[model samples]
Target: MELDDLIGIARARWRIIVAVFLSALALASAYVFLTPAQYKSTATVFLSINLDQNNLSSGSYALSQNVASYASLVTTDLVAKQVAADLPDLNLSPQALVGKLSSQVQQGTTFVDVSAQDHDPVKAQRIAQAAADEFRKEVQSLQTGLHAAATDAASLPIKPTSPKTTLDLLVAAIIGLLLGIAGAAIRDRLDKTIRTDKQVESATGAAVLAKVIHDSQASTKPLLTDIGEFASRAEAFRLLRTNLQFVDLDHPPRVFVVTSSVPAEGKTQTATNLAISMAKAGHRTLLVDGDLRRPTAAGLLGLDSSVGLTTVLTGQIDLSKAIQVHPESGLHLLAAGKRPPNPTEVLQTQATRDLIGALREAYDAVIIDAPPLLPVADPAVLASAADGAILVTRHGATTAAQLEVAAARLHSVGARIFGSVVNMVPRPDPGAYAYYMEYAPVANKQ
Candidate 1:
């Protein structure tokens, strides 16, 4: 990926990265604390060939070649056994002691370095010294004209060689940070939910008319009366009203269907609020709960839903008598009335089309709150009758695939797709929200 792509992923998924990093750091710290500390010490052994007066140059060359071979003998079982016997108080076996022993020839010299590691510094030094001594004795026994002797005694180590706190923590931190970035990149790749206005526009091939900020009080008070006009939620609806009017200049949509791909995506809420915002703007708006399968607009606005749309469609009540005006916002409401068994069949009839036509002539704007598009054919039918469909999708709740499917369903019926509404968007920062609220009233007056 390009640098810009990675940067975007980091910005969007920083929390996941931070969480993974902290977890890895914690694990590394636990390992450092629980693992035993190890101390290391080394002794140097010098190897030289016994030179005859006649062959001084040949003896020196032989010693240089044999120096590496002598270093290898330091790790032998014979050397470990001797060291173990010498340090019997430490209770290390020959096999176990061999694991702690190492040797290497010093470059450009006839010096063999023998090292040993142990939890205790004294033991490490004793083992290194004994291993050097034992290696020298083993070389003498070979009688190959080579002589070996300890040149430097092993020094006592005051600090541990393993579990270097600062270095270990630094390495751990780097590794943890890398893992966290990888995890965040993977998560961002896998997530398919709709999160931004751009994604909605791309998927639905329509502009995002509005982004409704999430409100905790919306469930108890669904209407704008409960949420003041100066609030962000009300401001969002106001923006929706303004955008809807400007979507089509010459032939603007006077009536439209508000629906989503699936239930609980806030389609009902969007329909209710948009109608109130339009009515508050002095437009004679009518909100019809066209979701005969499940009606909620009347209940949301505290209006009588017992005799409305279905009653008028069945010819049981006059259209004007069935429509109720919300006292608070002056928005006309036509409830779903008694749910019919055949909702799809009821909405597909000519009566439904005629009702939409009649409402379009009577009101400045008519918003029909329809059921989810995927589960039933009610919304597609309603959209076909109305001017267009305003698909309402919840932020992070509706997947791209679901939104695409809903848009395709609307397109199949040749329904006009005006635009989309993104619901329950994350609230802006507190300072920004307060600033907007403080100045919104003055902006409205202007």
Candidate 2:
């Protein structure tokens, strides 16, 4: 991924990253404080050769070869047993003493260092010193021409060495940061929710008309009829209405089926508000409740659903007698009336198509609030009878795959997708809208 993509993922999942990092640091802290402390002490032995001045160089080379062998003697069973006997207060067996002891030959020198580590500082020093003495005696017995002596006696260690606090914490911090970033990348890869306008446009190959900001009061008051003209929600619907006109300047769509990929994605609310917005702009608008499976548009506008589209289609009443008017927005409404047992079969009738044709001539704009496309075939059938469809998708809820399928279903029936609307976005930064509203016309502000 590019730098910008990484930055975006980090910004989106920072909480998860921070939580993982802090948990790692906490675990490291617990380990550092709970572990037992160990003190280390070291003792050095030097080897010298008894040689004549004529053979000085050969003697030095011989001593260097023997240095490594002497260092190995420090960890032998005999040396460990001897050291255990000398440090009786330590109460350690020969095997335990060998585990505590280590030896290394100084590079380019005939010298060896024996070290021991233990919880008791004084015992550590005694073990090192005893091991060095035993190694020295063993070297003397091996070669009479060589002399081995204790060069530096072990000293008492003042501090513990096992718990290196600073280094351990730094390593933990680096590992934690790397794990956090990897986790965030994995999460981003797995997420399939549609979030931005660009994603919807790319998936459906249609322009985004508007983004409706999330409102807590939207569930109770969904229509722009009750909201003021200057409110942000009303302004969003106005932007949608204006964009609809630009989709095709030559022959703009007069009747549109507003639906989504699934239920509760604000399709019903979008249809009602779009009709109100058109009426507010001095156009004759009519909102038809085309969803026979679950009708809600009539109740949303406080109208009577007892006599509507179904009543007119069944020859029980005329269209003029069944249509109700929303008092607040002056928009015409055609409720679904009573739901039928077979809604798909009902929407496919010739009468329904003729009603849509007649309504087109009676009104300047018409919005049909239809059921979700994926769950039922009602929206696709209605779109085939209407001019086009306007897909409504909820932010962080609808997946790109579902939107693609919905668009494909419409296209299969020769229905055009006018555009899409991204609904329930988080409120914008106040400064962003303030700058645009500053240049708004005076009449719009009122």
Candidate 3:
């Protein structure tokens, strides 16, 4: 993925990334705290070649080359083997000793430094001295005269070289952080869920008519008065209502099927509220509970749940008797009465069509709250009967893939998608009171 995509993923999954990183750091800290302190010692050794003074010029250059060659030999297996033999107490073989020992040659100089790391300072010092002694012996074996003449020796380190706790923790923390970011990015790429209006528009190629802000007030009252107090949500519904008017009234979409990709996305609530709002504006409206599987409109609106659309469609009851008028707003309510065995067949019958036609002639708008699109074919069948359908999606709950599939299903059946409504958007700012201020003037005007 590109850098921007990686950045977006990181931003979205910041919490997960942080959690992972902190967890890794916590583990590293625990390990460091529990680990025994380790000390290291380094010894310095000088390598040189014996040269005749009569040929001093060429001898110095040759001696310098020999010193460079001796540094390479210090890292050889032969040197490691000899060092292991010299330091028996350390109990390290050539293979095991390689990790503990390191050698470096100084530039423009004939000195080579040998370093060893271990848990104990004395062991570290002994290992460094042993490796240096072994290397020195190998160098002298090349020439007996040089072995007898050489006076340079290995020196003991004044201080321990390791257990750099601060550096280790810093490096561990950095590694942990990078790993966390990478994991977060991967998760974001794998997630195909819709969380915003931007995703809906991009996926479905449909206009987002309105984004309804979540109002706890709307949940408490049957009337719009409670929601009217929150101007933002009320205004959003008003805008939706106005947009609905723009659709040609001659071939008007009188019956609108409101459903979602899944349950609990406020489809029923939207239908109820939108119907009430239309009724309040002096338009005769009817809200039908088309979801025979799990009906909830009757309870939500405090209406009698004895008989509704299901009874009327099944030819068990008459349409007039099945419909009930709301006491507060005069909006009609039609609940899904007694679950039926063949809900899809009942909905697709001639009786259902006749009932819808009768409701259309009687009411200005008929808003049907149908089942989820993905789980059943009930909503698609209802949408085919209705003039159009509105897909209600809860922000951060519904996914892009689900909505796309739902739209495709609707299109396959020649169902017109009226528009999409993004529900449950959180309040934008904490301090802003403009919505409340607008409500005050409207309330006073009312």
Candidate 4:
């Protein structure tokens, strides 16, 4: 992906990144706060060699060159042992003391520096001075007559070199930021869900009929009556209604099985509202509760659920007795009826087909609210029987993989797969709905 695309993904998944980043920073801060403070000190010394009268060739320069080489050997066991003997408090062995001490020589000069680190500032200064003194004595002894007596002394450093809080925090912040961005990228790559219309169209090759704005205020009631109060929800259903009218239905899709990949995606509400809207347009509409396992249409509309589709299908009651008419809109409802044991089998029967055929002849539109496709085969069976199927998906809840699998499953069974409906679109921009709402005529009281 390009940098801009990656940035967009990061923006979408920013919560996960911030969560990981904050967690890492908190751990770093805790580590820094809990760690013990350590101090460091340095001691400087000048090296020189005695020049003979017979062979006087820049004795000071030669001493400086020799000292530069010898400075590297200062951290060896021999120098450390000599330094250890001089200090009673510094009880560290040569190997153990190597990490705490360092030495460096100035270029083209006879000066060498020996640095020591410890938790205590005073002890660090004392160790640096003592180590340089011991090294100087050892060098003079080893050189014998080649070097003069040591004229220069080592001086203790005034400042501590460790516990650099500012530098530590700066490094920690950089590490934390990298970790955050990496986490966000990983999460974005791993997720295969479809949250946008472009993704859905790219995956399914189906144009988005409408982007339904989710109404926080949308209830069981139809959108037409409350179009003025809940403008977004009313506008969404109206757009969907207009789009359906354009579909080239040979016999006009009287039976539409509205379902989703999973539950709680607003399929039942969409089917119910769609049916109500169709009925309001002077068509005799019948909303069937095909999900016998967990029927919700009758309860949602506050209608009598004494007898419904199941009762009519089982020959216990006729269609006229089973169908319940809504008090507000003239739309009729066929509740799932008493939760039958074998809902899938009931929906696939020839009797059910004949009943739907009869309803299609009698009504202008018949919308069947079926169960989720993934969980059960009830919707698939209903889809096969219905004229067409409208798949409903929630914006952030449903994944691209799930939607594809659902559509493929419906297609596999020869179910007429109509275009998808993106439901529960939260807080859509005014521009998105402005174009659709402009076409809707202003309401007038008769």
Candidate 5:
């Protein structure tokens, strides 16, 4: 990976990296404390030929050839077994204790180095000394007059050799760092959600009209622009309103349908807030409950919905008289009067088309809160009559496939899609706006 890629992974997954590293370090520390301390000791022995002055050169040549053989015998099972027998108090089997004994010698030298390791320093020292003594006795039994004596005896070591706590911890940290990098890369690959302005444009092939920050009080106060001043959310809707006016310079979209791929993607909320924002901005905005099956616009505005769109469509009441006005926000609402059977048939009628056309001419901007596209053909049918459609999607809650499907459904029928509005996206910090490509690589100096 390049330096930037590694930095990005570490930045995105730093928490996992730190947690794993600390966990490994903690385990290493525990092992150091709980495990018995191991100490190592080595006993040096020097050997030479017992040669007469007349034949010293010949005897030395023979002794040089025998040094390697003697060194090899020092750690053999034969010698190790004897050493084990001498340290019976340690209770180690000959085979189990065999690996701890080892011997080394220099080429053409009359010396052997015997080393031993044990949990107790004193035991290690005793084993090293005893192994050398036994090897000397074996040499004597062979009737070889070669001299052997302890040059430097094993001493008690003050420290342990097995745990190597610092080195082990360093190795563990490296392992943890690798694991974190793998996890971050896998997570980034597996995730298929569209989260950035770039991703939305790439996936839906449409410009973003607005990015509405998530608000906890939106459910209660859905009309963000009803207040006098525009907060961040209100300002965002105002921005959306301004963008809608410029969608077509010759003729802007007066009547538009607000719908999404599936329900609870904040389509209704977007419709209500956009209508209110437009009305508050001195536009005669009318919000119609196009979704007859599930009417939410009326409930959101706290208006009486006993008689509205369906009541007027069926000629039960005049459309003009059925329209209610919100005294606070100056917005108009035409609620879905009653749930009618065969909603698609009712919405597909030419009369429904004519009524929307008439409403479009009556108001400056008309926003219809239509049903979700994939669940039914109602939103598509309604979208056909409207001048344009505003696709609404929630951050992470809506997938790229769903947005594509919704766009394709609208496009198939030759409907005009104005743009998309990303709703309920996380609010950015003072210096943060990373919702879409929310992850950034941290700069790391090597």
Candidate 6:
């Protein structure tokens, strides 16, 4: 893959990368600390010919020939047994002594090095010294006229040859980093959620009405227009309000039910903010809590829910008395009062339709906070009464399949869908949201 693609995958799944890397490093650390340390010791032997000055060159060639044979003999059972006899304290058999001993002749020279490796430094040194002594004796016993002499005796090693903590950790970390990156790339490829604007439009075949950036304070500050928190977020709602007006110029959608395929996708908040923005724009907007299953608009607006849509539907109170005006934003709130056991029947009634018609005539706009379409049919039913519906979906959380199903649900009931709103978008990448900056006026900076 390209560098940019790899970086994106890493950024998206950095947690997985960190987890895998730490796990690998921990295992490497355990191995480094638990494994026994090994020490290696070595002894050197030199082979030479005792010859006259006239035959010096020939004697050198003869020693060179004997060196190869002597080196090969060092690993023999005879030499190993002799080494065991030399190091009586070691109590090792010929086979065991040979396992720890290694012999190699220095190239272009009549010299050989015998090395031994073991967990104990003292044993390693003893083995190397005994193996070299045995090898030199064996060469003399061959009666080849070559004199074999010990050049240097084996000495105790101060440090170990294996269990290198730092080097092993470095190698392990590299492996872990590679594994983590690979896993992230695979996960991104397998992800089914629609994360980008192009994906949303491609899935629903509908223009995105608004892209609401994610805000941690959204729930605490539900009404952006309510508290004068006029920032880029507020401007997004205002732009949405303007775009809705332009959606159907001849017959603009004034009565809209904001909903999604599932709960907590920011539909209720969108509906609440949209109504407030409409009111801020000087439009007589009536925000109704149509979500009987989960009525939140009334509580968000701080309005009394003892007498509301239910009271009016039951003929216990007039629709005018059921409505409460927001003292801050001038937006009217009709809470889902006394949540009925059966919201489906309540919204399906002709009285509900009549109430919507009256509200549309009395007010410039009526935005209803309806229940999710997939869970209940209340949203679709309420949409049938309103001019159009606005679908709210959380970016990177809602799958393309869910959006398609939601759109189909509205279409099946013959309800007009004005457009879908992509909500809870990532706020970090302002570079990607340059288009929305045009609508974010200087007066709206938070």
Q: What does the lDDT read for residue 423 in candidate 1?
A: 89
Global lDDT of model 1 = 0.90
What is candidate 2's lDDT per residue for 1-446, written digit by digit as tens? 99998887787678778988898889889988998889999999998988889887898888898788878988889999999888888789999999999999989988889999998899899899999899888888887678988889999999899788888888888888889988998988898888777889987889999899898888777788776666778889989999999988998789999999999899999999999999989999999999998899999999998888888999999899998999888999999988889999989999999999999999999999999999999999999999999999999889999999999999999999999999988776688778666756665558
Query: Which candidate, 2 or 6, has the higher lDDT?
Result: 2
Clashing pairs in 3: 194-399, 194-400
- Candidate 1 vs 3: which has more lDDT: 1
- Looking at model 5, the pairs that clash are 8-441, 195-436, 196-436, 434-438
* TM-scores for every predicted model: 0.91, 0.82, 0.74, 0.76, 0.77, 0.75
lDDT, residue 252, candidate 6: 71
Better of 3 and 6 by lDDT: 6
Q: In lDDT terms, how accurate is model 3?
A: 0.79
List candidate 1 segments past 4 Å from native: 53-62, 215-223, 228-230, 427-446
lDDT of 2: 0.90
Q: What lDDT does the true structure give each of the candidates?
A: 0.90, 0.90, 0.79, 0.77, 0.82, 0.86
Q: Scored by Cα lDDT, where does model 5 land?
A: 0.82
Q: Candidate 6 — which residues are off by over 4 angstroms? A: 1-4, 29-37, 43-113, 118-126, 135-160, 164-166, 211-221, 225-251, 422-446
The worst-scoring run of ten residues by lDDT in candidate 3 lies at 145-154
Q: Point out the worst 10-residue segment of candidate 5 by lDDT.
A: 436-445
Q: What is the lDDT of residue 210 in candidate 3?
A: 78
Q: Report the Cα lDDT for residue 335, model 1.
A: 95
Q: What would the C-alpha RMSD of candidate 2 be, to one decimal place?
A: 3.8
- Deviation (Å) of 248 in candidate 6: 4.4
Q: Which candidate, 4 or 5, would have the higher lDDT against the true structure?
A: 5
Best candidate (score: TM-score): 1
- What order do candidates take by lDDT, descending? 2, 1, 6, 5, 3, 4
